[model samples]
Target: MDCLAGSARAVPRWRNVAGASRTGKPVIVPGLIVANVAVFVLTVVTAGSLNRNFASPWFAEGALVPALVANGEYWRIVTSGFLHVGPLHLAFNMFALWIIGREVETVLGRARFVAVYGVSLLGGAAAVMLLSNPLGPTAGASGAVFGLMGALFVLLRRLKLPAGQVIGVIALNVVISFTIPQISWQGHLGGLVFGAAVTAALVYPGAVAQNRRRVQIVAISGLALLGLLLIGAGAAFL
Candidate 1:
């Protein structure tokens, strides 16, 4: 459900509090990659197979099933982002994660990056619950990966940087999402829309204000609350 096909050139360095220039290598990116891989390993070890089977305990317990979520297994909305149907699913998503996560984490900083990712993941689950077959379960990190891509796209545009390659990559991915069987296009679209919206909320306020950091915090919190309300409505109606 995911692929890497874009590159971003390094931006000019900004000075830190000590007046020293820093490259800002990302910590959360690697940590997220590790957590995902560990969960995949645990799934393989526990389930003893990589094939798709909803009856599999891992899928039954963790994958996003609309009915199950509506019935109070709401944790699946988040957990499903960490689960995968097979090795290739895990590999593709992890590869995409590695490609984009570092850049986004560096640009947004650790806390805001985490917020974007968490909201995007929930957005994907909410979309799946509302738009896809209620009885079918979906699992993967494609939604989160797409969300990071969307965030990067918005950041590049806001900075007035060249965004042609990023736009092309997103277009290609959207086409692939629709053409491929078993792919969750609802999740992809939902994540992209929500990611762009949340990132815009986080970054646009800084454009006109001196207290940009405080504005960003307030904007992100408002978006988070809004996302929660949307997800709650989706679950209730499902």
Candidate 2:
């Protein structure tokens, strides 16, 4: 851990390096949008007179269901986000990404964006794992997208961006949760918490002075604690 030189005061000059080299360039997380579009198209094509019978294929039906995921159909949970039940569902999520992802990718660089998004997806999976019933179908990028919200919030704070704007957007999304059913609030909340934590760890590496070190430590620890609580709460609900 590289401590800030000399003075044990202040936040070590806010040196925002362009994240680690591992991420390569900010990979356009088009995977989420692209995957969803393709799946939706396939679902429409295969509906074939069966109206909504897009699930004849084990692969398509497995998208929203979690038990299939634990039982080796694991790829579907990740892939399911790409497929939507309808155009409206896909449009809303992709549009949200268009608005927020670019800024975050710019801040953390391409590599960090990928890390944050990937982890958030995993985090969302954890929620479905704990709460979803046997083969309970699940889909949507809202969880991973919420993870973006969490990550974006942290980065905005780290860079000292305008708070009113950022926080308002978050609150609005939260409001949307109440009005929407089949929204998978579980996944969204889980991903949001995880994304926020990961971003905090990356942004505030504890290699600094006492005050900052303590702050970073506390922030990271809080994230961990929240994750534990979320797990417990989710388990209780299950």
| lDDT by residue (tens digit), candidate 1, 45-119 | 777766643346776789888888888988888888988878888888999898888777766667778888987
Q: What lDDT would candidate 2 get against the real structure?
A: 0.63
Question: Which pairs of residues clash in candidate 1, taking residues 3 or more apart in a chain or in different chains?
Answer: none
- Candidate 1 segments whose C-alpha is farther than 4 A from its true place: 1-23, 52-55, 206-210
What TM-score goes with each of the models? 0.87, 0.72
RMSD of each: 4.4, 7.2
lDDT values of the candidates? 0.77, 0.63
Cα error of candidate 2 at position 229, Å: 14
For residues 34-88, write the lDDT of model 2, one tens digit per residue: 7666767677667652236345363365475655554556566567666565667
Q: Where's the lowest-lDDT run of ten residues in candidate 1? A: 1-10
Highest lDDT: give the candidate number: 1
